[model samples]
Target: MATLQDYRNERLRKLAALRELGVDPYPAHAERTHTCAEVVEKFDELIGQTVSVAGRIVSIRSFGKLAFIKLRDASGDVQLYLQKDDVAGLDASRGVLGMKQLKLLDTGDFVQATGEMVVTKTGEKSVGVHELRLLTKSLRPMPEKLDNKEERFRRRYVDMNVNPEVRQRFIRRSKFWQATRDYLNQHGFTEVNVPVLEHTTGGADANPFVTHMDALDDQQFYLRISHELPLKRLIGAGFEKVYDLGPRFRNENYSDEHLPEHIAMEWYAAYWDWRQGMRFMENMYKDVLQKTFGTLHFRLGEFEVDMSGKWDVWDYAEVIAQHYGIDVYHTTIDEVAAKLKEHSLEVEKTDSIPRGIDKLWKNIRKSVAGPVWLVNTPKFISPLSKANPDNPQSVERFQPIIAGSELGNGFSELNDPIDQLNRFVEQQRMRDAGDDEAMMLDIDYVEMLEYGMPPACGWGWSERVFWIFEGVTAREGVPFPQLRHEIDEVTKAIYSEAELQ
Candidate 1:
């Protein structure tokens, strides 16, 4: 069995041989008149006409005087036919390789083929090559199969090549975000990119990743845990309809639905309440989902979700009371903790009444297969939401429950500085009492609130939405997930002379 290093060494020797022959093995340019897919799709019209195609060589077969190469580009793959008598000789200046030089090419090498469309005797659509040019020479061949989770993530580029479905998943991921932007833009929302680093991060109950800014007197700054505060700050700055789509960092452990860092989008519409926001999101969800997946219905895990129909509205307080027998408005910390323990949930010493009740709610949420809006959450649990006028204990907050998880959150923006300050102070007290996930008090944001932002409704959701609908884990959904740095023994041995550890 030849090891990877042995195969690499063999390629290296071939690279040297090509160099010695004055052939440019790694050329800077190649010509492509059509994609592999186009060659096949337009075959009837393109028949007998010379066309240039470039792609990675996926396969090669030779029978004495004749050979075939399967070239694969992003669009698709096509076959190239070659005959020793008809092909041109090597041209070092143009980087063209004759039929005799095909022995130097490998399966993973990139090449351009200029040929006339034809059908083989066996009736396979292919290109009859007159000229072949080397574009790139791959030293390390891609693995035939990449199924190990650890290796797949570590070498994602190789995983994408070996498993094309992984590549297609990311294409859909791009579509998901593009659909979001399309819907938001169609609704007249102006996208403004906000700062990724903040002096005080306070949007959510998640510990933030900290960093030092040498340009700003070496002050300690935080990687933003949410885009909510800064985007809302734009609302205070007189932006009527605003949104941002970018990465946010959260210093936390991973879960199936959560990553320490992920892309999220938040939008705010001035003068809109939670109810209006709810309606807007329903349409946006339908539009985005239909555009990305081409359907409004999804089978996510064991639950079936249909975004086309009217979504049910569930009162947060009522759901908690009915499921766990605890009034969210009047629940005691001890009572919440006891219920948490009875339900086999996490009961931490730092768990406040709000946190404990939330855990109990999530337990019930696990069974709900819904496109449901969970509204009227307690004011204490929603620090940035406006308090409901009808019920002061509850805030005008709304969350979309889908496939047993909260996919999105929205709130009637709280613009009252005094109320926001009090909530911040309360959250600070929780932090002092050993709750590391409590929101930090951002006085600057409070000052902006004092300056008076308009009545608005704000909503945000992470790429977890795409992950959920796409039926992939947090790590799998991302092209490259963060992993602890490590050098394998094989890699270290390969680079031993370069002082690799």
Candidate 2:
């Protein structure tokens, strides 16, 4: 890390270098322009046109008397093949530019160039430089090579120079959101913005980020865990289709697949069932993938998942029973506990048999191969879902598992006021038993249900969907992840002395 003093000294050197050239380091602007894309798009036609552009100086190849300094600007990078004869307009004849022309130059320097686009005999489209300037200087070194893996993530600017694939992923990410907006618009799903600060948080298990509310003085507000509550209010107001795609907070552990904050694409459809939820998601996911990647088959890890295919389905209970050699539906609580113990599965069932069953099922779920619907969950486990008519003990819900992880969960929502109340009571009991992740009493939501919310199937999925689809961990999909940056040694030293006092 560069200290403030280091930056100041580097700036001084840069100022001195620019003064030696008799040019301003920070010019107001470059006069006329063309982007890297425009040059490439109209290459032969743009051959004699002098166009100005600016970007980080990533590479500079020097010949004896002439310098082939590669200047890259936005929309992409192109080499500025600078000849000794044509270096007059942008810089003076002496100082650091001349020294850099003479000695080795590092990577992080920003430069501007005015040149004509021309292709070399090597078939490389490069800028034939008529004028060149060092817009800024870099005291520290950049990636030795553009594609250097050691610097790929730490110094992303260098990675952008060499890795076309990184550019492709971000481009595709933009396209993915655009397709989502397009698809939802066509389907009558209206985009919405909801409040981020909440008095009471629900709708998901993850903990929330805490912050003080100035208006309320000592009152603390939480960053929302899920957009479920607010979106539901829109349904109450007669909007059948609503969606929210934005940042969500989760005060939780970090991993390659879990960020404290991430992007979530959540939507609700009124009067839709679990089956309908499954179908809508399948169609939406397939369409989004095709729109972005031009194919429905995305390879996750070592397995290729075909999104366009009929997604395989299996009973949720059956998934567990198959793994542990016991029919969970027919077995007693003691039997299930004994079996899990026998299998050496560490589960705290005595805390709550339902929690124990949940843990056991979660372990069982990981072994599932490919995309399969783990449906018909035990009702006690999923409080918000409607129980199946034939099997009152099980809920009409399905988890869409892809690459052995649940990408989405859906259920026929409990619209029956009595059933919902009973479930809420059950949840309250769990909370009382010290399960903070359990749902709390939402009297207002229950009142909304009492007002006759149509028997709707609700679906909810997290940002992990995009992470898996992109073949990157969830952490990489997000811009600023939760991993800790190292504390400075000076700060540590000061804190240590203060603690002694």
Candidate 3:
């Protein structure tokens, strides 16, 4: 393998060549009046015009006796036809450019170019080179352009230069988020930020990541798994409509479907019901699909999901009855447990069979495809939801499931203080009984409910939306993904006994 020393050797040679030409290979700065993109955009207006432009060299077509090069900046790419007879900078760094020279210029190298735009005989966009300046030298080699690979597209900053489709996806990703914010604003939802750190807490199930602070002799909290608990307090304080679209941290399993820290869009509207939440979720995504991709059909793995179609609503208990021929309200817990065992599912004797049924639904969710409102969930599984008025058995909650996994959890938020406290106490018992995923009894959240917060439906969904709508796995969407056993250099330094102690 070519090593970093080999890179230093080649770059030193370039430095020597530039020194011989009396030019600094690494200059402090370059002044330019136009970007490669702006020149091309205003081409008709700047025809025969001398424009000062700056960009990194992207493509070079050399005619040994002469050369043609393309330079790119964030705005766009511009081509340069450098005829050796008129060129000023070729003598020092001379060669048939290797994909490796792309290494020398670096696929990611920053550069500046001064040129005039002109169309070649083939009527292709091209620039006549007058001058070139190096910004930052790139030493790393990029994937071969003609390889037409899939992974390079996932490392999409590199692919954006070579693949038009990859570039367009990112462009759409940008617009997709912008459109969501615009929609939220139009609906009178005020954006609010919640503290990631907590002392005494309330939120969804799952263990929190523990962090310590020596100076205060306190264990400083790391961050939250979800934004639900804090946002609810804002609801209690009378913010009628609120939303938070940001990153949430969870210490959990790693899979194509999960990331430890991920983006989520949580929204709460006062005086709303589970039905209202359903309408908003269904309509919000359909509009986002239209605004982003201009269509509702998204290729989810091998299957196609139509977002614009009717969202089939399924009751949790009814679906369980339909799927397993067992109902918790009508059947004994032991019978539910027995049916699950008949289906080859197992659970600790301490766990209720409804918990086993919950597991089955998650497994079956993978086979399901589309926008589905999975409602009327079991009370044992959803601690934050209100028990149904009619059934009193299942909670009034549902998740928007798409492509098998839940897009998010939503419900008619439980605001009755007595019932909420009882649920919290039950949760504490579950935690004491060795279920670490059980939530702690958050007395404050219950206290706030006693103050009479309005009956509002709140939904918290982490942005597995990118995974669902964009047709990629959850881990595939995050930029810097967490690796299970990888020890990064910077982290190692911080974790060293001398530093940590």
Candidate 4:
């Protein structure tokens, strides 16, 4: 039962041994002609040709005068065959420094190999090494396996090293956002970067993380909870089509689907309504999904959703009536709260009437396995959306629902300054009434609307799309997620009772 320090000490001895034998344990540079994947893919063309490859040594096997090392690079893995005779002719300066140098190399160390491609008798494609150079000497040994979720998240670098699938998932996540940007760029959308710090945060119902800026006369600022307000400001500035994709912060509860900080994308298009927005959004989803995952079908949780076919549309009021037996337009806040309590659903006492109804809808939404569009939202629940002309009580809002959650939100933008001001004022009242998640009254945004913004459509979605499609929690999809600091046993033992006093 050796401690980690003991293992480290042994590796340190090897480091010293390498230095004594005129081998640099850590070199500044190494030659690499091909990646592991390229070497494997072009094996037939490259056979008998000397090529250089570099990677971390994942595994090693020794048989008296020969050794087999499994090398892993970013692209893929390849086998390297080392023989006592091959190393004698590698370098004239370090003449015939044979098996001793190879024995010093360990797993987790990065090494570069110059070798000729050959197939083993057992049919494994490998490189026969004539030269080997240590690129980096790893001081700490990697864990045999990373099984604990918290540990894996805390040490994502190690987790990714041990788990190839985890690495692939992040690769796909990059492709997902890239595909989104490509689709928007093709549609003539100008990508604009908005300020992350704001005096008044609005555009979505969420508690904001606040900080004070010393440079700005000690004024308090909030991290932008949503990209809505600033992107719309661009629309008022006469940008017909604008979009932003970046990080946003919200001081709210953490769940399988939620994170305190996450990447969000929002876009606004002038002279377009919610119907046109929906059509564009559907196509965007299809294109991005195909580009990233290479298929329309995804297994998210227990549901298998297919985005290739036509998506179904459901009215918000009708959905609530059918699922919860409560008409969203007709039900009182108190009555809805009572119904939620009857079903043992949790409700916050400080929530506004609209928030209460929203919570009820969310509970019902869990049963909906859909690539469905939920439309005709009640005006109170969607203050930023334009009111439907035919039905003033409802707003022209649509949400893409998938696997029991709202995947994204879109609506016909409410550009009338007077109406927008009134809605902001109402929302402010809710904030004053103790609903911390209520949207703030952004007077600047209202003033921007006074300058006359064109009728537009807006939509937004977060990286939760990646999480849903990959069938992972929000924490898993993200490379590094926030976690509470844990006091290790050593730290606890270091702090004595006398120090506390």
Winning candidate number (lDDT): 1
After superposition, the stretches of candidate 2 with alpha carbons farther than 4 Å from their true spots are 1-12, 19-22, 28-32, 63-65, 90-106, 119-124, 145-167, 325-333, 349-351, 488-501
Model 1 residue 329 CA deviation (Å) reads: 1.4
Clashing pairs in 4: none
Write down the lDDT of every candidate, Cα atoms only. Answer: 0.92, 0.72, 0.72, 0.89
lDDT of 1 by residue, 425-458 (tens): 9999999888989999999999999999999999
Looking at model 4, residue 485 earns an lDDT score of: 78
Q: How good is model 3 by TM-score?
A: 0.85
Give the per-residue lDDT digits (tens) of candidate 2, residues 29-50: 5544777667777887888778
Candidate 1 residue 72 C-alpha distance from true site, Å: 0.5
Clashes of each: 0, 1, 1, 0
Question: Candidate 4: minimum summed lDDT over ten consecutive residues — where?
Answer: 88-97
What tens digits encode model 3's per-residue C-alpha lDDT throughout 276-365? 888887888888779987888888885678887789988887777787887756767777677767777765666655567776677567
**472-493 per-residue lDDT for model 4 (tens digits):** 9999989999999775564354
Winner by TM-score between candidate 4 and candidate 2 = 4
Best by TM-score: 1
Give the Å shift of residue 39 in candidate 4. Answer: 1.0
TM-score of each: 0.99, 0.85, 0.85, 0.94
